[model samples]
Target chain A: MTLLTVENLTLEFDTDEGRITAVNNISFEVNSGEVLGIVGESGSGKSVTAKSVMQLNPSNSVYSSETKILLEVDGESVDVLALRGGKELRTVRGGSVSMIFQEPMASFAPAITIGAQMVEQLLLHKKISKAEAIKISIEMLDKVGISDADKRFKQYAFELSGGMRQRAMIAMALSTNPKLLIADEPTTALDVTIQAQVLDLMKDLVVEFNMGIIFITHDLGVIAQTADRVAVMYLGELVEQGSVRQVLKNPTHPYTQGLINALPKLDDLDAPLTPVPGDIPSPLERPPGCVFHTRCALAEPRCSESIPQMTNHGEGHSAACFVTAEKAEAL
Target chain B: MNKKPIISCRDLSVHFPIGGGLFERKQFVRAVNNVNLSIPQGSFFGLVGESGSGKTTLGRAFLRAVPITHGEINYSDGEKDYDLVDLPKKQLKEFRKRAQLIFQDPYAALSPRMTIRDIIAEPLEVMNLTSSREETDELVREMAHKCRLNLEHLRRFPHAFSGGQRQRISIARSLVSNPRFVVADESVAALDVSIQADVLNLLKSLQSELGSTYLFISHDLSVVAHICDMVAVMYLGQLIEVAPTRELFSAPRHPYTQALLSSIPNLDPDHQSDAQKLKGEIPSPTNPPSGCKFHTRCHYVVEHCKVVEPLLEHPESSHDVACHRWEELMNIKEIPVANLA
Candidate 1:
């Protein structure tokens, strides 16, 4: 069953200058117990799309004709987009879904104890007593490998290390046993060793809890390790989506190939990073044709005029490009 | 042949006292404890460690941003030698002009209120390296050209530029003073993978042209492996191993070094799940374990390893290890570099 389905999601930001389209007509589905990786550049609308899942966008964000997110709960579909206020959104925000952000420090309250926050979240989402909530929060912290859960329970966010704070945040997010977890650059702030540990913990939780996750990050190396299925986003569009093996090993889109090629290899230090030649077009001056046509080496004149729709290439693999799979193979 | 080391450290240590009270003696956090490093003239010496490994503190000690609690940091550029620890105010100002620092965050490092030209020229004006405005502009333009920054962009503030361009501006500013030794503290760590190469190449080219030594500090082993000639591994304020990049990767003598080298994710499909995962976290530097600091989590720790602190001993020319059981563990061959490829 599809745990979450976003269809024709178009979001525009009404700024002082003019209307800017941030996410443009994007659609994807997350199944139960699936880890979906959203890979993109800095301004690739990856975070915006993930944020849209929990309705966390700014109030100034403008919606187009149709932007539907159908979240299935208890065999009933809920129109999450129709949730007008925090009261209604609260039903899905923490009860059914939870999010982890890039900077743990920013997400956590500086003055309040982490345990209090976790217990409060648990009480808000579930019908549990204070004592029970506290017990559950401590267990979750222990599960996440906090050295002394009881001692750390009373400590503020500033007292914890970067890795510890991140773990605490994860523990808090998972305390509600949310069916869907939206993590946006959760490990970007931590070092590689701690990142690996957190990744392993997340994967373990996904198995133990049987929950779907939307992992958003700019690093493809990270996506490779955690994502079961991957989606590549470029400049407000979903360029490609497929199983992790197919997407990573045999990436069909030129942009995806360019990104993979651009990554510096740890083993082959001699190989130079072949950066896609041109800079990403500013969001205001978005190109009419393929969004990636400006930097694509294999772009044709046709690519500059017509926007390509998503086309299926193989099992669970699709790419939005005018170039055929055979031609892309030749490149 | 003895032109003297461009930068040398003899028992360098930087400690921070925390938890002050009557009951507590104010225990010291040994940020950089007993660190000894020697960077030859024009050599790019790499410092590799995870966070809290004191790599940044060590780098700052060289630049005099952080005070040296005990020991000596000697600086020599063939003509003059200065004991960096005991430099007088007049000589310290001169030393500042000779040694420069490249910060990690280019966004924060470059002033948002200043234009690129002013940001680059500020160093020159502050150090009194140039006399007239035209001379400053000429040097700024030269450095900007070398860094591949557009001359027109120099009129704009750092906000107008991307992370890569801002980093280029930062590099240009650091180079404006014409420093002999540069400490690039995770300079390229914040950049995109595509831009990291460009910045690294620029650093390499600048070194060749200027004949400057770089104390390159980064947590990314792969980035260091590509650019650095010699690599040093640090764990809990101590240097565990140091060797040529290729030699260290191929045959890491210390267990910690071996674990770090193997922990780098291999892009190759075959080596995905087989990468040796490092167990546990880095211990706190405030109260590090006795004997070998890494013994707490070391897989091969024995009774002797727990009781005796291992000294940094040379195993080969330009190669050093700080583990007592290295000779015993030498038989356990490291993961082949070709396997990752």
Candidate 2:
């Protein structure tokens, strides 16, 4: 079943200069027991889209009238964008959906103990006693592989190391048994060994809890290791979406190909680090047709003239590129 | 390994004082613990390690940016030999001319108030490398061009430029003086992947043009493999392994190096990796492990490993590893590079 669905979600931020559309008519669904990896560089609007699921965007963020965020919980459909600040909205925020940010230290309150924060969030979300909340929070901490969970409960965020802090944040995020988890660059700031450990922990938990996860990062290698299905985003546009095997092995879009080529792959040691030519255009001056045409090597005249629609290439694999869509049609 | 070592370290260490107050007992965090290695002239030397592994501290120790507690770091580029440990005012000033540093964050490295041209030209004026203002401008513009930055944007401030362009400016400033050795501490970590490749390529092209050595310090193993000639692996402030890129990747001896190499998530979806996942986090540098600092997390650690520290041994030519049972472990063919299950 689909745990969450976002359709035609367009987001615009009203700045001092002008209203810049941050997310341009994007849509994706996260089913329970699935890990959907959203891969994109900076300014790709991956984080913004994730934040929109819980209506966490700033007040200036204008969502289009066509935008609809539907949350399915216990057979009840909820229009998330329609929810105002009340207990009704709590069902989606921290009740059914949980978020973990890239920097664990910044996500937490430095003044509060890790356990206290976890208990506070749990008490707010669930109808449990203080004692039960504490007991369950410690269990969650132990589940995430933090030893001496009892003692660590009283320690502040600064007391723990970077890896430990991240794990604690994960423990706190999972304390409520959230149905859908939005992890935005959770391991991007961590060391490689710690990242491997965290990735393993998350993979195990997803299967155990049977919860959906939206893992967002710029690393293709990371996406390959963790994500079951991958979505490639470019300047707020979903350029490609497919299974991890299909998108990584047989990438049809030029931007996806460029990103894969740019990475320093360990297997191919001698491969040159070839970056996609040209800079990502400023948000104010978004490209006329395809957002990636300014930098795409395989861009044709049609790509510059009109935006390409998402074309299916068998087995649920899809890419929004006129060049690839025409080739697939020709075949 | 045969090329002349431009910078050499002999038991160099940097211990930082931590939590020492009038009432509290004075303690030290051994950031760079007794590391001995040599970087060949005109080669991109990589130092790889996790956070708190002292990679950055060791990089700064070579540049004399941080004061060392013990041992010597010598610099020799076929002309001068300066003892970096005890350089006086005159020699220290001259040493500053030959060595430079590139910081991790481009946004934080460049001053926002300064123009691009002035930012690049400031190094020359500070070092007194150029005689006149016009000479400085010419060198700055030439360096900017080499770094792929438009000369027309020289008059603009750093805030006006993008992340990639700002990084290019920082690179231009570091190379304007034409330093013989550069310590780039995670220089490309802040930029996007595409821009990172561009900056890395520029660094490579600059190396060929200037014939300078680079101590490329980063936690990223793949980027190190892509550009570096010699790679050293550090764990909790000690050099565990040092070898040529191919040798280290192909036939890793130390369990720590093997685990670190295997931990890298391969881009190939079908490439099965029976990679050994390390058990715990890196131990605190404030009070590291007794013997091998990595023995606490090493998969093949023995009781003896916890007591006796192992010295780095050359089991093969050009490969150095600090492990007791490296040879016997190598004989046991359970694991190898290109680890496919």
Off by over 4 Å in 2: B339-341
C-alpha RMSD by candidate, in order? 2.3, 1.5
TM-scores of the candidates in the order shown: 0.95, 0.98
DockQ of each: 0.44, 0.60
lDDT of 2 by residue, A186-248 (tens): 999898888889998999999999999999999988899999899999998999999999999
Tens digit per residue, CA lDDT, model 1, B234-304:
99998999887778876778888777766555554344655456667888998899999999878889999
**DockQ for candidate 1:** 0.44
TM-score of 1: 0.95
Q: On a 0 to 100 scale, what is the lDDT of residue B337 in model 2?
A: 78
Off by over 4 Å in 1: A324-331, B1-4, B19-24, B268-270, B333-341
Which residue pairs show collisions in model 2?
none
User: How far out, in Å, is residue B224 in model 2?
Assistant: 0.6
Query: Candidate 1: lDDT of A175?
Result: 91
| Chain A TM-score vs. truth, each candidate | 0.97, 0.98
